[model samples]
Target: MTAPDDLLRGVEATLFAATEPLRADEISRHLGGADVRPALAALTEHYAGRGIHLVERGGRWHFQTAPDLAHLLRREKEDVRRLSRAATEALAIIAYHEPVSRAEIEAIRGVQTAKGTLDVLMEAGWVRIAGRREVPGRPTIYSTTPAFLTHFGLSSRGDLPGIGELRAAGLLDPVDEAYAVLTGSGEDAADDGDEDGAGAD
Candidate 1:
């Protein structure tokens, strides 16, 4: 067994050179299968308030800029797309009820989801096709991706904000309000886009 001090240092070096976030087991494999959790905990504590802090998202460990100092490094911000109300709604649905089918999404939305809506989310790497649900036509199901966790800084789906939180954050809207107050969050009307046969695909 490597000495405690050496093990800690080795774990730090391995994570620092990693091209992407690594799982604890992956880190252990790199250290000749050494028990890496203790070292990881120590490193996590060591970097607690530093410029870069170790964080685990969706079972992967990586260092991200500390919350307080992140702005210092963002000299130029990336121009990212702001999700439409429909896209945001669909995302929340998938996050809460993952491995859900397109028909389920439409049913919950009370409107046939436009084909491009899920496409937009997939393009953003926040959603993915999880495979066909085992039934009738085997409709494609959707789920939030790990990148969704990373982008949102969530440790897991369990970390997703609750309804009250979303309402407080001003992210919740009339559609959500209607859905919550009524049936399983379904709206009262269909969309013009879907009515025009865009939902046919």
Candidate 2:
């Protein structure tokens, strides 16, 4: 029988060599039926204080730089591509109210959502087509992807900040005040307005 240390080494090597994150069952199978839970737990604890951390995201396990230490390894460069206001607003809407249709998004924003806005988010791998809503015309619904959570350093959608938190962080716009009122009461205001028609360049 392989010792505990040997088991940990095997799991470590497998994870290190993987191009993508691996599930625990996959790790167990790789070791020819070795029980990997304890080894994984041990490895997680062992790496807790290290520069790199073993973390599980979207049910897959991988190593990531320690949050505070990550700045040290980042290369400074100009970020030429930035999300447009429309895209940013759409993304926030999806993150907060997932599996929502484009029409629903527009209803919340009180403006017709541009196709390119969703396109840009899909191209970024942050949003994906969840499925069709079981309504008339069956419009496609959108939801945030695992990559979205990973990019934002969130473990799940529940980790997203609430309205109060956003306000405290000064991340909310004045227009968001109206949004807060709408969403707070679980009611959508009348869209007696024109489509904003904003698009990403």
Candidate 3:
């Protein structure tokens, strides 16, 4: 008979190999239920003292490399990507409160974002249109992309750094504070002079 311990090792291997966080249902399907809990617990406990740790968030599970290893990883290559104050704010709003409309973004920002703002994010492959809102005149909604998670070295959106983390890093630039003083409604909601204006594509 296969030992529950071996079954758990299999579960742990599967979990560790996944690039994205796995839902419990998916994990359970991979490991037979009778030994699933014991396997999961054993794997979790086994990695407790290691450089990597299994983490659960937003009902999904994944392994995260330890923060202590960050500096060491940095030595492997030069980090090149750095977001500007406005870019960071726009990204944050999209990430935390996704499927948000441009109008909503303007409201939070308190001033209009330039045309290039969303374009830049999209160009970087970090943001995309989630879908159009089901309201009158249905506006297109935007949300962070999986590429955003990968670029940030996060296994999922839940791993996004909080306000406290930003403040601690001394990288918290209050882009919104300046928005309250601006006059553009915090959105570039103007018509693009398209011949088929108001037509949904």
TM-scores for all candidates: the values are: 0.78, 0.77, 0.62
lDDT by candidate, in order shown: 0.77, 0.77, 0.65
Q: In candidate 2, which residue pairs get closer than 3 Å at backbone N, Cα or C atoms, i.e. clash?
A: none
RMSD of 3: 8.7
What digit string (tens of lDDT, one per residue) describes model 3 on residues 94-115?
8777988888877776666665
lDDT of 2 by residue, 106-147 (tens): 888877787887998999888999999998899999999877
Top candidate by TM-score: 1
- Which runs of model 2 end up more than 4 angstroms from their true locations? 163-201
lDDT of 1 by residue, 38-64 (tens): 888888898997888999899989989
Give each prediction's root-mean-square deviation over alpha carbons: 6.0, 7.1, 8.7
Evaluated at residue 128, the lDDT of candidate 3 is: 97
lDDT of 3: 0.65
